[model samples]
Target chain A: MKSMLRTETQSKRRWRYVYAIIPSRKEHDFGQIGLDDENVYTIHYREIAAVVSDSSTKTFEVLDYGITHQQALEKIMKEYCVIPMSFGQSTTEGDIKTFLSRNYPKLRIYFTKLVGKTELGLKVTWKIDTTIKEIASSNIKIRAMKHQIEGKPLEKTYRQRLTLGTKVAEELTKREEKIASEIFARLGRISADAKMNKNLSDEMVLNAAFLVDKTKEQDFDTLVNTLEQEYGEKLLMKYVVAPPYNFVNVRIRS
Target chain B: MALIVDDLLRLPVDLGMKVLQAIADDADAMTLKTERAVREQVLKTQMQFERGDLPEEEYRATMSQLRKRLDEVKGV
Candidate 1:
């Protein structure tokens, strides 16, 4: 009864959940530890291969699934140049081949472009109170407006308050743009390519991903450290190292 | 459903049909108005948060509630 139960469990682990594709050299099995630690392996074609594992479950917890997907991609990336799929992307081995065959040109392009490169993410968020104080003290027009309303009661200076508010908004927007561009310029030189994501929250001033050479990774980290130290009080810097390049390379329709 | 439950029980059969028809005609408009209001509210809160009038935790909670309301309206 125990042997039969084990055999049924083994047969249950048949469906493959693909994680990403890398250059084909040999058929390799990365072992269990994929989505739910199902045996991970590869399906090789002519010059490329799909990294996959047994997809035992028909449904998965989205958050947990996402973490496992990223972990799988990271594992593959450690030894090979991989172009990752969007999170939770999975299919059978046959469908994976069809996908590879259909998108061979783009796949080849991705392979060539990402051969020895990895992506890094940087997010910079302004300390709103500190930045507002700095702006109020340094901006001449704002300082003048503040001077006018220095001792006036709120009810009496309503119009001036409104004017100052509008002016502050405009000036803050301009400053954010200027600062974002300045930071991008400073780091963009060391990167092979860079993409800016729309800020996810109000505190965020910059959310950008850079495609960088593996060899230059340390230099990039050092530069980021210096920038963080320089803007220590004014902004918070979050740096992510060698994340999967899905931000730039994950969208292939075919 | 609330409109029907609250008013349908009190009305005579003939009047209830008329009221049901009226509600049926207005249901789409009501939902549209609700979606627009939710959208505007989200934008306002987002602006307040951006301008530093709202704190991050409060803004995040408000945005999450607004998004849930939006999804309910969209029936998603």
Candidate 2:
């Protein structure tokens, strides 16, 4: 939201941000050495990556931390080249290395195909204020409550309002998911990976990752452009492709 | 240790495939350490981490220490 954090150093083993742990399989690590270290049992993964936390404590101290997620996502294009792991990934070193080596040939081929590429993650969200306002304007449920409450006790009337609010929340979830899914579904072929962020909020409607060939970055841009021209207001889309800009290139066109 | 494994340990996508190929390649001497054995070991560590019995930092710390010790033994 603010600005992505960045630094210049001669660090060799670069770490990049993959939005979450789910898509770890997408990059096809194919034995090319992903995690840097493992714990005592030689099973737990402790990567010697550069992904540091954006939390202030890690930001102030770079020598012993990974690069910030904000830094990785913001620079998706130029300097950072990243292969995002789907949310939630962990493994031991020896097994993981063997896994990589086994997949090494295919993964090497994957690297040649996607070496300079970056993934852009874009999500669309809508706040409740507008949706609630729309509901109040069109739905007769509130009007019926107002009419019936004139004769009932205040507590009873308040309980009815609470019920109305619950229904609104439920309907909002269903409607938003439908809209979000339909839009991103159109992008199925263009993406190497896609996922909807269902954890942050029930209202999170759209979450997707688009893998673009370096030369076709503009094609992805045009696809987004078409979406904005149709649904600019009431929808907010934020995105980043890594290794290029550690600063989020946020823009909203009216 | 009495071994315990997590769900990821048995993921059809990752296991079997990595080791099976090496076994087929004829150049590997890892006949004893099959995929299932490695998987059981990885999962045991993971289950410990998940149950809050093991701290991630401590787990990684121990893993690296073993790797280092192994390297020393191999004189590599």
Candidate 3:
């Protein structure tokens, strides 16, 4: 009896680490698939349910847990449309039920809009040296500046070199913008919605996410393949189908 | 030292405690802000590593350094 009382007290102290919210009235046991091999399950309140695991700790280091959290969401997405909760969201079971009860209508609308759709990521990069070479040949002003600087001592033509560098950078920005817009326009036509993410590097020309309906997923894939072929050796394209990390993040008030 | 003692004697005990508490709270807030900023940097570093911008050795070194800073801020 004393051990049972200790068990009860420990259970009361454990918080629910939420992964996602799905539209379901039935309870589910996702087995021991959570971080640290915890049992992942669903807690239902009417038609909405929160996918969670009993966690003793409230805070998680993102470096250790971020990928696990995303993988868990992806696993759950296979069977249901997931409204992903941000990492480190831990609260009591009672609070989750109350939250679900209060936000049922809004959550239902998210599911309605998100069903039968997926997010795809596209990143385009180009070799900076090759692009600069192409720019120097085609841009007359840059070509003339380069000709003036060619074979001159570094100290003697410093000012001309600076101007030439500035011109090259300006041309690079213009070219990147043009290419990004064209790519976005092509893919945006087939997507329900699209978002342009910040490019991470100088070589990266485009970083974008598209919310495409399941029906148009194949068409989107074909278009991306076509783009890859068209760009050939000039650009490197990386395409991936991912969870709508950019589109939806459900922030539940604790 | 005598003048400092005189000022402390003039102040009420609860008021002195409140002043200390406010300073502590401000320090706590600053630590929390630094912790959050470090966490964001860690995430950005991870994104760069995943995007192939940062090499493996450099990524690992940066992540370890950031984690140490995070532990320091949190007093872990």
Candidate 4:
């Protein structure tokens, strides 16, 4: 019975859940910060190491553990140029070592490229009513249409009102694109690379991530501040320093 | 009885096996497609929550439902 239990336990083995890879030759422990408060540590191969914690679960609920995974990477990022793995990556220690050995050259290249760089996110949104009003007052065609439809019976001015609404929407989209392009251009010049993410809502004008060198972070901050001041309350901007989630996603299949 | 057995042996077993294999392959492909779609939805939900489009309570409720669906699809 003891032998059978031992074999059963061996069959249901634990694996290392990897969070990120860093360019370090020495092994280090980050301590009980992983999922379920497991001891997070580094598994080393040559000059690269994977920050990981022991896990028996093969699949993780991303909604529950996603924040923990990101937080672990963020903690490591303060000291290391981290190449983040997508959530729920787990494998045996031997497989991890073999993977690091096989992909050392490529991993080194990513490390070199991403060193001293961090990603910053900026989102800009405007009030739809305010923006539509602004557009209507600025565009002569739209303004004329609004005037022609004003104070008319709903049934009588239905088609005219529809046309006016479409015109305003088109102008709103055009204005959004124009502003987005200008903002992207200004930030892109100072960033090593920039990606435009999809806008979540109609009110959103821009959703973008910029990979900026640590040296240029101050300049990026100043530019964002200046842009906010320039737009005032017309545009609401949310900016945050985040991990390079958009830039590098390392996947290892075992 | 021998004749019946002979007739059964002459049936297109290879074609039946091929059909079965194709169905299995299709099922695997469908699972992969569903997994990809669900993952994308999960990401979209996360973004919606982060952008403050959904309140925390609603976000958690929605995420819990999605997590259940994902677990079902994964056979977890």
RMSD of each: 14.1, 20.6, 15.8, 17.2
Q: lDDT tens string, model 1, A83-184?
A: 776554555557777887888888888778788887877788987656666767688997787777766676787677667766765676787898888888
TM agreement with the true structure for every prediction: 0.69, 0.45, 0.80, 0.78
- DockQ metric, candidate 1: 0.02
Q: How well does candidate 3 score on lDDT at residue A102? A: 89
Against the true structure, candidate 4 reaches a TM-score of 0.78
Error of 4 at B28 (Å): 24
**Quality class of the docking in candidate 4, CAPRI style:** incorrect
| lDDT, each prediction | 0.69, 0.41, 0.77, 0.76
lDDT of 3 at B7: 29
What ranges in model 1 sit over 4 Å off? Answer: A1-14, A56-64, A245-247, A251-254, B1-76
The TM-score measured for candidate 3 stands at 0.80
The DockQ scores of all candidates, in the order shown, are 0.02, 0.01, 0.03, 0.04
- Choose 3 or 4, whichever is better by TM-score: 3
The best candidate in terms of TM-score: 3
Candidate 2 runs further than 4 Å off: A1-64, A68-102, A146-154, A242-254, B1-76
TM-score of chain B of 1: 0.56
Better DockQ candidate (2, 3): 3
Q: Which ten residues in a row have the lowest lDDT in candidate 3 chain A?
A: A127-136
Estimate candidate 4's RMSD in Å: 17.2
